[model samples]
Target chain A: MEKCKKNRKLIWLTIYNELSSEQKSQLEIHLQACSDCQSDYEEALRLRRALDEKIQVAPTAAQLEASRAELHQRLLLLSQPRLQKSWFDKVWQIVSLDFAPSWRFATAVALLTFGVLIGNFYSRKAATEYNFYQQQISELLESNISNIESVTYDPVTRQVAIELNTLNDFTIQGNIEKPEIQQLLAHSIVVRYQNLSIRKKIPESD
Target chain B: MGNEEELLIRRAQRGNLKAFEDLVKRYDEKIMRLIFNMVSDAEDTRDIYQEVFLKAYQSITNFRFASEFYTWLYRIAVNTCINFRKRKTIVQHDSLDSYLDGNNDNWQILNTSEIRNPEEQLINKELSEQIQKSIDRLPARQKSVFVLKHYHGYKLSEIAVIMNCSEGTVKNYMFRAVQKLKISLQGYQQL
Candidate 1:
């Protein structure tokens, strides 16, 4: 049963006559004893004959000729060299007297140079304007230092001393969870510390 | 592979349009038949026919003479057809009855004068239609394999080369295609 089951699939190849000589002999031996396989083979052969009767429909000669002609035209176009302006035509266009080419070239260069000069002037002006705005912002930030008790700059040590006044004059030290201290520290960093040129400092008791 | 064909190929490779056209003429009929058998739609077949030759002409310079010119050409035709089938979203199912009723444009060509008896003609037409439908129902790869094998009479090895698959794989496809065709065509065997 196992052998017949496997041989059933080969029935197609057998009907198509694609089996090797040895396999064909083996299958022939199997077919002599196996009525079921024989019937399957017969069915496959019938199907093959039906498939063989299919008429190969060719395109009409007219269609073929039309396609050939179209393809030929397309191929001709593909093979043909591209149309280009001749060197004489290019030179004539460039040297044509309606507009003097040299004067046009000079005008183009002058315009480009003037455009570059104006672009450079505007860029420098914009940079200066940006610096001025930055300076104003720094001064504006400095004005928000109301809680800072005093700011002393030491030239010898190259340090700026910043003293802060608490609301109750009590030194409040805690974690970053303290909102007031966090706000004060943020303001000090953004305003005084960012702009000041300070290196090292030590608090002095007064 | 003939000396004359070789000369033509050389000339075609050298950009001789006449030589290329001659090559097209030599194989266009068979190629058209093969494509039409694979794709029953006349319009799609015509488009693929034109595309195959145009592609061959465009890429003639790349012909390295590694295989027969026809095999190389068949590769292009098969690939183009496969891609064309893939690009299409709707499958065009041609009804054989409608086609045989003189509605199809190619009906006149298919209905040759060989069969004078109307009854026999009808039977033959139905059988052919059944066969085509079976072939059409196959998956694309199996369809190509079956068409190339049975319709074109190409050997399995040759089919493998044209399909760019192993011979075993081609045989497997052929087996599955034939099995499907057998089951689909079981009722028509007595006729």
Candidate 2:
């Protein structure tokens, strides 16, 4: 009787084939030994048979065919896009799961082309700027001054002179601490060093 | 699902309307039956049936094939029926007479068992009415569990997935549903 109470749940599960074989075998053994359980089992089977008999509620072929037609109409409407798809939905379709291999390939090629074009444009602009600066410096160094013959500091005159052999030999002499003189001397040396580096980067004409 | 059905589902997931329609034809009958047994009304069943497949169509893209398509589809059907019931006024458990008015074709005997006599036929009708009333009386969750378990013949574990409840909860529901029907039908015999 105590076991019968526990096995009652199994009665329905057994009727439905929801029990494992072990539990089924156990219930089978119990049903053989227990008359009350046997009646319960039989009753459950009768109930299932009756439910099975009465409740074959599946839409008949005609009914199903009708539902399918209606469902198709509704699905047609459902699959139809709104006047417009939400931008996010469009983007998600493109960038996410539904993004096609062809689209991905196109996207990749587009991006790579954009990157190359951007890189090419900026590099050419930068190279042009660098070349322009180089030309100006080389003109200052190679054309404006033939050579620096000497840079002299004279204590008696309290001045510094930078003598050059040029289109015409000239001297720029001023107080050594003068801002203009100090700046010019610094600028010439810096430009000359930069011109040397830029020269190395330029390909030598064959 | 067989490989062919899986192909159909993949196509459907990608928004193939024809493929989705094929899936609908394949599964809608069972879904309609589940709905009919659930709501016990043809119009309501049709509405829920439409809602179920429509929702499946709308949301098929989200289906990751994490589970079988039928289980996922059943979840949609069960929830749609439950929600449709909740949205309408609760018609307290009562006569299925009016509900059965236009639903004659929904009833089919499993074996087409020939009736011996009118008396037996009357008893069978009474038994059928009683069974429907018993179903109508169960709470929504319990009724879903009951339908999925007994009518749909899903194992408790599968029902657990469909119901989105624990297996133990499904078991308890099945037990209660059985007990209710057993009590309700006790007065009738051999119908």
Candidate 3:
């Protein structure tokens, strides 16, 4: 039974004619003595015959010729230097390069740092120009002090009040729409209004 | 390798189109048949057939004569078919009857006068289809192994190289494929 078991496993290879002469002789001896092994061998032979004689499907000559012709045409095209690499090949080429991961990380970091530096420089430059314009507006407002009676600013409303001493002492009160007025108010808020009492005094005077 | 094949490979490597075409003509039939057996679809087989040679031609410059040209070509064929199978959902269809009938030459060769009776012909056709279905049901690796070993008559070692696996693994796949096929075709054994 053990022999039969082993022979049964080799029976398929035997039927397929894959065994060496020694193995074939051994299997033949086993088949002759064991009916079970004989039946298995016969069964395997039947299967092989079925596959070879009946189930064998081959490409027709016409099909083969057509395939060959098509391949020939394609090979002709490929014989020329490829004008374009496939996107996948391009990506693979890039990825297969000798660049190290550390190099990639460094490049990304450098770009990020460069971007941040650029952004910071522009922001600081804009702030400096703003401060310069505010200083000029405050100087201009100081020069026009002869035409003004009193200057009142409301921090909450962001409005400014100018009590003109011309004609009748009327007050001109509106939100600071002019850059000059905004600068003058911004100057007073930043410099002179360091103390809350002084800051509150301007709103109370109105 | 034969001196002729070596000369052909050398010429093909040097951008000799005629040498390349000769090489393709020599192997295209076997390659097409292998692809057809692997995929069991004529259209897909043709596409893979074209792709194999095209890829070989495009990358011929990289061929360093490390192995036989056939082995290298089979590697490309096997890999291409495996990838094609992986990328597409296999829709099993009963087109064997059409395939057999469409190729009357194969039909005549397979069905001689002794088995020409209508009933026996019908039974044989059905049995063949059952066998195909069994083969189709095998997993990809097992199917490739079985097709290469049984259909294409490749050696176990050759299958190993084509599949890029160990000989033991190829044998295991072949065993499993045979077992599955045996079980599947058990009903038609008496015929």
lDDT of 3 by residue, B1-191 (tens): 89999899899888998898889888887887778777777678777888888888878888888777888888898889888888878554436666546544421123454456678777877876777788888998999898888877888887887778898888789878888888888877663
The deviation in Å at residue A145 for candidate 2 is 62
The Cα local distance difference test for each model comes to 0.75, 0.76, 0.73
Between the candidate structures 1 and 2, which one is better when assessed by TM-score?
A: 1
Note the residue pairs that clash in candidate 1: none
lDDT of 2 at A31: 95
Of candidate 1 chain A, the 10-residue stretch with the lowest lDDT total is A166-175
Taking the tens digit of each residue's C-alpha lDDT, what string does model 3 give over A83-199?
Answer: 786899766755554247767766667668989999999999979876765675555545433344556767788788756433444454556776766655565445644342331
The superposed Cα distance between candidate 3 and the true structure at residue B172, in angstroms, equals: 2.4
DockQ score for model 1: 0.32
Q: Candidate 2 residues A72-153, lDDT tens each?
A: 8888877787797799998787555465676887876776898999999999997886566455445545566645665666
Docking outcome class, model 2: acceptable
Candidate 1 TM-score, C-alpha based: 0.65
All DockQ scores? 0.32, 0.34, 0.30
